[model samples]
Target chain A: MANILTQNDIQHVDYKDIDLLKQFVNPHGRVMSRKRTALTAKQQRAVEAAVKRARFMGLLPFIQK
Target chain B: MEMETNLSEEGGVSRVYEIGYLIVPTVAEDSLDKVVGEIRSSIEKAGGSFIAEGAPSLMRLAYDMTAREGDKNVDYDRGYFGWLKFEASPESAIALEESLRTNASVLRHIVFRTVREDTRAKIKAPTLREVKTPRTTLAAPRREEEVSAPVSEVDLDKALEDLTTE
Candidate 1:
């Protein structure tokens, strides 16, 4: 799939937006890597940071339970 | 009092803030407002000015969070959700966080400094992540004495010989 960011024309990702965050997460709740998602280096980093924040805030789980 | 790292690029010394908090769903609508109002007052008390906010909405939590009510452990499966965008002095933001931590009705919360959507800029590359505490895969401790010892063949043979001798 094309990188979700460019496909949707989303420049910045918000940690609070679960809908957008979900797209970056795998079925097992792991965040997809740049290689897997085919995201640019910048986009991948943005997702990683957002995912970490979301997980810490309980918006997303570190692992599927 | 503490200070946020980001200084406003806008026409002020204070930074813009985004706060997200989850409240236990069991609270009545009136009581919910009361709790939020308390938070608002606390923020103001610390010298923060309130900005517009979305009304709190009841939502099912992704997972149950255990909360202690009196002496009992209460499992909160649902939560009242809300987000506020405001401008506050760094000192007041720190105070707001301290108050949120002590608020009993709050199940979880997070706060951060943010730029306006219109002025949002390029993304920054992140460094490798560090390992953190595990959220799952619990290993309960088991004492060796609690496990029954396995019976050996020698022991069984000795028991048979002892019975015959008797």
Candidate 2:
């Protein structure tokens, strides 16, 4: 799939946006790699940080069994 | 005044921080304002100035989370979520976090350094590209069989010439 953030012109990823962040996570609740997501290094870092923050706030699950 | 002097003596530099929190679902809706007011007052007490905030709203949690209450742990499937952006000295920020940690009404919280400008993503619709199909024949469209057939050397050269001229 094409880069969703690049396609939508999204520069910064907000941790509160769990709906959008969920797309980058796998069934196990693990973050997808840059290769799998086809995102730039900067974009990948932003997504990683946002996901971690969301997990801390219980907005996203850390592990999905 | 005393706190300001102490901070200045330590050469403390104020930095922007955003705190996101989850309030225990047990809190009555009518008393939600009182809880929010407590947080705002704490920020002011810490010499922090508010930049922006999202009022607490009830929301379902992604998974069941347990927080200690008295001697027992209570599982929660929902909570009031909210966030606030402010500027405060690093020392005061840490102190503010400590205070929140002891508040029984707070289920979870996170504070991190951030910029004053809004950095949240604004998703937009993807723009579609128009594709142009080249017409191989001017007369009746070439049959599907002919379309897949190999082009002659003459046609290849003509196509190259057309591309270069364009």
Candidate 3:
């Protein structure tokens, strides 16, 4: 299947939006299972990578410490 | 298992540092090189290697810092955000913090520790590299014009004259 995230989709997502992150991740800090999210493995990985980058840049909260 | 534990704990892998600093805006633009050099030398002296430096990003302070002896009444710092990832002893890290704190040029600073292993492994394990879109010729000139604007050297004399006239 064609990956759900196109280049434009990734470009529009700044790796900083909290709601976009929540769509791919759970409050428990785990990536949402691909079956539930309906994302191909590649798109899933991309979402996970973007979330990590967002957390690193202080744009997203990874875990409550 | 004990041997593995000892090896893992020996140096415990180096901690990565991400440091940011704010300096006085009135400082001459040309002097940034000297200031950054001084900071790098200090980090190196404490056994750290500088990794990455970012372009200065202008920022506003969350709160005003009260002026004391030499400080002006208003704290207006133009942030020159730099990122340095280095390996150093914990003692050296403490010294680095102290040096940044004492420097008159630096208005504020913070050091965050991160893991290099994750970053390193991500880099080493190659994935499909996307080819960048070819730059259109028409777009290149616009970018160059924007870059070539002598923003740093514009109208200093006129600005000073304006101040005097006022």
Task: Identify the candidate with maximal DockQ.
Answer: 2
Q: Backbone clash tally for model 1?
A: 0
**Span of ten consecutive residues with least summed lDDT in model 2 chain B:** B1-10
Q: How close to the true structure is residue B89 of candidate 3, measured as C-alpha lDDT?
A: 61
Model 2 has how many clashing residue pairs? 0
lDDT of 2 by residue, B1-166 (tens): 0112223444777778889989999999999898889888899998888989999999988888899888998999999999999988888888889988988899999998777767666652223222344565455665676456788999999999999999
What is the TM-score (0 to 1) of candidate 2? Answer: 0.75
Error of 3 at A48 (Å): 18
Candidate 3 chain B weakest ten by summed lDDT: B1-10
Report iRMS values in order.
Answer: 8.2, 6.3, 11.6
Error of 2 at B65 (Å): 1.0
lDDT of each: 0.74, 0.83, 0.56
For residue B95, give model 3's deviation from the true position in Å.
0.3
Q: On residues B1-166, what C-alpha lDDT tens digit does candidate 3 reach at each position?
A: 0011111235643455656566656557788777777778889997676666555555443334432437546555234544566666666778889998788776556675644432221211122123456778546655444455564545878788899999
Q: Rate residue B162 of model 2 by lDDT.
A: 100
Q: Which stretches of model 1 miss by more than 4 angstroms?
A: B1-12, B118-166
Task: Please list all clashing residue pairs in model 2, or write none if there are none.
Answer: none
Cα deviation of B109 in candidate 2 (Å)?
0.5
Q: Choose the strongest candidate by TM-score.
A: 2
Error of 2 at B81 (Å): 0.5
